[model samples]
Target: MQITIKVLKGSDCTLEVAPTSTILEVKQQIETELQISAANQKLLLLGRPLNNEQTIASYPNIKEGTKLNLVVMKPCLRDSIQRGFRKHYPEQQAERLTNEFMTDFEKKLNEQSLDDLERFADSIVSRATT
Candidate 1:
């Protein structure tokens, strides 16, 4: 099955792994793909830290199409701007924009942002359209 890794402020990617794969193995795969160190990766499944020692089967909620969020305490600049070159492709552009929004939302959540989620989302929509 495919597991979707959502980098809080970056584009999401899917990885194919066996159900018995350990969460740590998933992190290792992510580290290889995103160039982020495993030590720096703080993974969450539904807003809770995902234990590295557990197998994917241990978390029933983590089956096919499950989204796991990866929070990088310090984002790498090269990873961000380096991803911008494909702006001409609509699909790539859309993905880049989604990453930008997720990044912002994650930042606010960390700061205990007082803004209403709906309002914040609406602002993003408005800005995107204009």
Candidate 2:
């Protein structure tokens, strides 16, 4: 079966796939066709996000010529921070610091509310300066 994928920022692509194919497999095909990584891709059908483990057959409404929305997630914050640290530190030190920072940052991220996110960002800036 052929389905159309509408990317949020790029051109739409059509893929040939089986009805039994998992969403992950569809993502892999999109990765091959569009050069977008599977990890960063989010597939949606009629505004509902598709589970990577689910199959096309599971969605009874989907058939030939169905259109799925593709949303690409932003790059990892850890990777960006690690790259910045690499400019000033050795590879091993940068890795260690990035890991440590991510561990604490993730904890705070989970605990902080949307209202507290501004304060959290300020604290991160202060920590980075010191």
TM-score of each: 0.56, 0.63
- The positional error of residue 116 in candidate 2, measured at the CA in angstroms, is 18
lDDT of 2 by residue, 1-130 (tens): 9999999878899999898999999999999999887988999998999999999999997899999999999868887798799999999999999999999988987988887988878899999999
lDDT of 2: 0.92
What is candidate 1's lDDT per residue for 28-103, written digit by digit as tens? 9998999887867888988999888999999989888999999987656534443454454476675776677668
Least accurate 10 contiguous residues by lDDT in model 1: 78-87
The CA lDDT at 111 in model 1 is: 76
Q: How close to the true structure is residue 12 of candidate 2, measured as C-alpha lDDT? A: 97
Screening candidate 2 with a backbone cut-off below 3 angstroms (N, C-alpha, C), the clashing residue pairs are none
Stretches off by above 4 angstroms in model 2 are 79-130
